[model samples]
Target: MDWQEISGNWVLIPPRPSAIVHFLGGAFVATAPQLTYRWLLEELAGQGYAVVATPFVNTLDHVAIARDVLNKFENALDRLYATKTLRKAYFPIYGIGHSMGCKLHLLIGSLFDVERAGNILISFNNYAARDAIPIVEQISPVFNVEFTPSPQETNRLVQEHYQIRRNLLVKFADDNIDQSILLAKLLQPRFPGMVAIQTMAGNHQTPLGQDVSWPVGQVFTPLDAIGQWVKQQVYRELNQLKREILRWLNPLS
Candidate 1:
């Protein structure tokens, strides 16, 4: 669990990893990826995957974001190879994204010649900036930022060009913001039986992180037991989600 800077990007690498994982978090989350996706990345690290969590303030121009994603991932690999940090510079690279991150991966797949094994799209949402970002609808008239791919354009692009062969779309049962079903519909025409859609009992933020501490000020409350039960359910769902993700990514295994 060490952090290093590569080509001006902060990355966390685990010791002696077998493969690589490129992670992208949801929209407007500019916090360090290492912190925002701490639980997911740490678990992946423990599973022997070198995870490179790229931090970026998600903007309207998703195509631009996708380009930057490629740059960071390629640059990281190049640096590792140049320094002889890993025996092999390139390994099976998997794309892992939550929410808006899924759109970027889909864009990457549409573009030709990216070395990606597969992708896991969790709680996918491709809402317009005005809709996705609260109060942006009110403020956009004053300061407009016409985000590229505009949700409609994202579909147009995917319909015109999508080269991904394997995809795993996971949607949580309680996630009302999820568009995984819609995404699966779009990808099914292109990838056919290649897309695997899995439904689990959790919400959009289930895999991100958890707070397990019980409320200490109160001796006990009726909701306290319910809260504990819900927390346990979250942990269980997350573990199952991880297992399904790994299973889909590692087909031969």
Candidate 2:
């Protein structure tokens, strides 16, 4: 997957205070299908954020495949930062992901030295599918990164921080709801303050595409509604990110 700027019907927000916000999309869908995501990117740009959404092939399932894709993303970020096409310096960098995209973010965030990254935002992270052993095994060789339990590692390595935010957002009405909760609990000990899971109504794939309006007492939720909700969340997060960038640029004020 080549890292490219998001194009087509999307608005661009100039970088504020030298910060860049990149949105990563999930599996089995092209980046274009994520209309709500597009809106979010535009909103972020409107708020003085230089937003870029990178497209990747969603064919791979294994953590190793995902990591390879993430490497491309990391390299693209480096190129973008080096060109300094968006803004000045001392700006914050952030990665935003949804669904499988969230998993990819976790893998990259944990393995890569994204310390310069201001923060990571993840939505609907279903950790049940990810094989921890394979993920750790694949990632360990890349960085010579062994799992040595330390204070900082304990905090940021797992999705602990994410859990705090999750308790507020979660609305469990489905069977797989436990998957999200369990993943957060499992990661708490290792990455005490890393993962943040925000809950929205619907199953794993509900928020990906368009939202639908179902009749009352219907068996399933409307896809259109879920899609709209996802889009709304994306817009809100991007807008906040833009504000953060603007603040970073004018720190003294």
Candidate 3:
């Protein structure tokens, strides 16, 4: 399906959508999520979901970023409803995020009064500004800066606030930078049996990538064969992630 821009968000709406998925991508590729996360988002759309992917430029103040994206997402929903693109009847809404996007979703869920059926956090990473953006330390040694809520403060907020009952934390097998386990510990207590953790294959960058067309040469070469194999692996990983998310999204029925 072709994506449309509404309220500064890229949206892919199917003819009949069972639910809506509000997606936020990782910091580096978030600016153009429609292109960077096209494969994953479109897969969700293909599975009867109206995908609303919001793009945001990353800054040190993650709280502000979260608030802004939430506002934009809500506004887009409003427009969709007003235009009759989305039915006025009750429909489930879920939040899905990758990498830094996961932290934004967490902050939004904790700080706002928005209603979400559940949240799917993939490769969650909450790093200090110095570590997330190494150039910040190299450029200025005099000032000490960090994310607005800070890593520790974010955890405190989640522990004290996060109201969402259903949460799915997805951690990749080879992702060294992932911190979903720590997040699960913080959230599991607040929600008890509602929190679930699922381990998947692939690394931090698994959620980012689009299909590339590998042109055939006059004669089939090993390099060409290797390219085809790599493409298959990428699609395999992406499809696996999609299946896991769809399974959690429809656990009961």
lDDT values for all models: 0.80, 0.47, 0.92
Write the residue-wise lDDT of candidate 2 on 1-253 in tens digits.
Answer: 1123522212244635345665666555534533645544554566665665656665435356446655655565566557764433565656555555555555565565454353343343443222323565666556644322222343354444322221111222442533456556655455446444454344444334342343334544587567667667644534443444344334464
Clashing pairs in 3: none
Regions of candidate 1 where Cα sits further than 4 Å from its true position:
141-145, 211-231
The full ranking of all candidates by lDDT, starting with the best, is: 3, 1, 2
Tens digit of lDDT per residue, candidate 1, span 1-253?
A: 7777786455666678778888888876634777767766777787788887777777777788888877877888788778877676457888898888888888888864786788888889988878888878888989885568788888888877887778899999999999999988998988888888999988988777743676644576768878878877758977887788777867677
Q: Give, for candidate 1, the lowest lDDT window spanning 10 residues.
A: 209-218
Q: What TM-score fits each model?
A: 0.86, 0.52, 0.93
Provide the lDDT at 179 for model 1.
93
User: How much is 78 displaced in model 3, in angstroms?
Assistant: 0.8
lDDT of 3: 0.92
Leading candidate by lDDT = 3
What is the C-alpha lDDT profile of model 3 across 1-253, one tens digit per residue? 7999999999999989999999999989999899999988988898899999999999989999999999999999999999999989888999999999999999998999989999999999998888899788875467777789999999999999997889999999999999999999999989989999999788899888677899979999999999999889877877789899999999774
Could you tell me the lDDT of residue 121 within candidate 1?
86
Clashes of each: 0, 15, 0
